[model samples]
Target: MKPRLAPYLFVTPAMTLLLAFGVLPILVALLVSLTDMNLGGLADYSRVSFVGADNYRELFGDAAFWQALGNTGVFAVLGVPAVIVVSLVIALLLDRGDSRLFRALRAFYFVPAITGIVAVSLVWGYLYNTQFGLFNHLLSLVGVAPVQWLGDPVLVKFSVALVAVWRGTGLNVIIFLAALQGIPREYREAAAIDGASELRTTVSIVVPLLRFAIFFVAITTIIAWLQFFDEPFVLTKGGPLGASTSISLFLYQKGFSASQFGYASAGTVVLFAIIAVVTLVQLRARRIDAED
Candidate 1:
C-alpha cells in the first residue's frame, strides 16, 4: 500500500469503532433532543412527536435542572482546588525521597483512585453514619455535636465534596508526581544555592514548570465534575431533598425514572456543548503558552 493509504488502513478499525460507538450515539442523542421521546413513545410509535425546541425551552424554566447545575458548579468550585492543592502537596513530599517506603506511600495514595467508586461511596456512607460513625465518635470525644454529613441540605454539599476531593486526589497526585519527576534536579539545587527557601523554590520554579500538567488536570477534572453522578447517587441518592443531584444524576432521573428522554437528551446536549467549549478554550490557551 502507498504511505497515505497505509495510514488510513492502520486507523480504519479504530475509526470505524469510534463512528459506531461514539459519533453515532452522539448523533442519535442530538436527534432525541429534538423530539418528544418518552416511555409512552417507546411503547407506541403513534405517541412519538417532533417537538423541535420544546424540550430545550422547558429546560430553561426547570427549577430542578437549575438546582442540579448549581450543585455541579458548587462541586467543581470546592473540589478542583482541594484536589489540586492536596495532590500537589503530597507529590512534593513524595518527591523528596525515592526509597521503598516512599514508593509504597505513593502506591497507597493511588489505591482509592483504582478502587470502584460504588465501594468507596459505601464505605464513606458508613463513615458518615450519624449514630455510630467514626467521625461522630471522634466529635463526641471532644464534646462537639455530631455533624450531619449527608443529611442536611446546608451541609450535604460539603460532605459530598469532601468524598469527591478524596477520591480525585490520588490520580492528581500521581500526575503531579510524574510532572515533578520530569523537572531537572539542577533547577531546584540552583535555587537552594541562591538562598531560596524550599517554599519559594517550589512556588516559583516547580509550580511554574508544572503549569501545562496542571492545566491538563484542571480541564479534565472540570469536565468530570460537570458529569458527576456516581458518588452522590450512591451516597445521598440526590437527597436530603435533591441536595446532591448532579447534572448527570438529574439526567438519569429524567430519562429513566420520569420517562422524559427528550428533556434529558437536551440537557445532555447542553452539557456536551459546555464540555466542548471549555476543552477548546484550554487547548487554545495551551497553544498560546507554547507560542510564548
Candidate 2:
C-alpha cells in the first residue's frame, strides 16, 4: 500500500467498529423513528408502516415531555453554574495551599466524584429522609422545622440539583486545580507587586488565564446536567408529580417502560440536536473570547 493508504488501513478496523456499533445504530434508530415500530412490530414486518413525522409530532405535543424538558433546563441552568463556581473556589484554595493537611483535604473532596452514583444516591436518600435524615436532625438542633427535601414537588428539582452539584463539583475541582497549577509563579508575583489584592488578582489575572479550562468545565457540566438522571432516578424517581423528571428520564420511561420506541427515538434525536447546538454555541463563544 502507498503511505496514505497505510494510514487508512491502520484506522480501518476502528472505523469499521464505529460504523458497526455507532453509526449503524443511529441510522437504524432514525429509520425506526420515522415508522410506527414497536416491540410487536419487530416480529411482524407488515405492521411497521412509515408514519413520517407523526412520532416527532406526538413527542412535541406531549405535556409530559414538555415538563421533562423544562425540568431538565432548570436543573442544568442552576446546577452547572453552581458546580463550576464551587469547584473553582475549591481548586483555588487547594492550588494556593502547601500544608499536607490541605493535600489530604483535596483527596477527601474528590471522594464523592469516584463513588458510584447509585451508592451516593442511596446515601443521600437516607440523608434526605423526612423524619430521620441527618439534615433534619441538624435543623432540629438549630430550632428550625424540618423541610421536605425530596418529597414536595416544588423542592424536588432543587434538591436533585443540589445533589448533582455536590457529586459533580469534585471533578471540576481537580480540573481547575490542574489548570491553576499550570500558571506561572511570576504572574502572581508581578500582580502582587502592582498592588493587586488576592481577590482582585484572582478575578482579573487568574480567572482570565484559566478561561480555556473554565470554558471546558462549563461545557462538560452543562452536557452532564442536561443528561441528569442518576440522582433523580435513584433518590426521587422523578417524583412529586414528575417535577424532577428530566428529559433523559422521560426518554427512559418512553423507551423502556412504555415501549414507545418510535417516540423515544424522536426524543433522543431532539436531545442530540439540543446538546450539539449548545456545545457549538459555547465553542463559538470561547473562540470569540480568545480572539478578543
Candidate 3:
C-alpha cells in the first residue's frame, strides 16, 4: 500500500464499524420514525406507510410521554448535582487520608459501581419493602411512620432517584478521587504558606484545577441519567401512576410492549438530539474554560 494511504487504511476498520453499527442504525431509525413501522408492518412492508411528522406529533401530544420527560428531568436535575457534590466530598476525603484502613474503605465505597444494576435494584427493593424492609425498620426506631416508598406516586420518583444516586455515585467518586490525586501537593502547600485555609485552598485552587474532570463527570452523568431505565424498570416498572417513568423506559415500553416501533424511533431520535446538544454545550464550556 502507498504511504499516503496507510493512515486511511489503519482507520478504515474503525470507520467501517462506525458506519455499520452507529451511522446506519441512526439513519434507519430516522427513516423508520417517518413511517408507521410496527412489527407487523416490518413483516409486511406494504403496511409501512409514510406518516411524515405524525409520530412526532403523537409523541408531543402524549401526556405519559410528557410525564416521563418531566420525571427524567427531575432525576437529572436533582441527581446530577447531588451525585457530583457527594462524589467530590468522598474523593476529597479519600485523597487527604493516608491510612491503609482509609484505602480499604475507599474500595468498599466503590463496590456498588461494579455491582450489576439489576442486582442492586433487587437488593434495594427488599430494603425498601414497606413491611419488612431495613429502611422502615430504622424509621420505626425513630417513631416515624413507615412511608409508602414505591406505592406513592409522589415518593416513587424520589425513591427511584435515591436508588440511582446510590448505585451511580461510586463511579463518580472514583473519577473525582483520581483527579484529586493528580493535583500536585505543592499547590496546597503554597496556598497554606500564603495564610490560605484548607477550605479556601480547596475552593479556590483544587476545584478550578479539576474543572475538566468535573465537566467530564457532569456531561457523562447527564447522558447516563437521561437513559435511566434499569432502576425504574426493575423497581417500579414506571408504577404508582407512572411517577418514576423515564424517557428510556417509556421508549422500551412503547417499542416492545405496545409494538409502536415508529413512535419509539421518534422518541429515540428526540433523545439523541437532546444529548447531542447538551454534549456540544459542555464541549464549548470546556473550551472557554481552557481559554481562561
Predicted candidate 3 versus true structure: per-residue lDDT over 1-292, tens digit per residue: 8999999999999999999999999999899999989999978999999999999999999999999999999989878988889888888888888799889978988998889877998899999999999999999999989989999998888889898888888899889988988999999999999999999999999999999889989999999998989889999999988899999999999999999999999999999999899899989988997898
Model 1 earns a TM-score of: 0.95
Give the number of colliding residue pairs in candidate 3. 0
lDDT of 2 by residue, 1-292 (tens): 6887998999999999999997898788788889877777878878888999999999999999999999999999889889999999999988878799889989989999999988998888888998999999999999999989998998888888998899998889999989998999899999999999999999999999998999999999999988888988888888989999999999999888888888898888888889989999999998998898
Question: If candidate 1 were superposed on the true structure by all CA atoms, what would the RMSD be?
Answer: 1.6
Model 1: per-residue lDDT, tens digit, 1-292?
6887998999999999999998898898899999999999888878889999999999989999999999999998988888888988999999999999999999999998999987998799989999999999999999999888899997899999999888899999999999998999999999999999999999999999999889988888888888898889899989988889999999999999999999999999998988899889989988999899
* lDDT at 198, model 2: 94
Estimated TM-score for each candidate: 0.95, 0.93, 0.94
Off by over 4 Å in 2: 1-22, 43-46
Worst lDDT 10-window in candidate 1: 40-49
- Local error of candidate 1 at residue 69 (angstroms): 0.6
Cα deviation at 268, candidate 2, in Å, is 0.4
Error of 1 at 65 (Å): 0.6
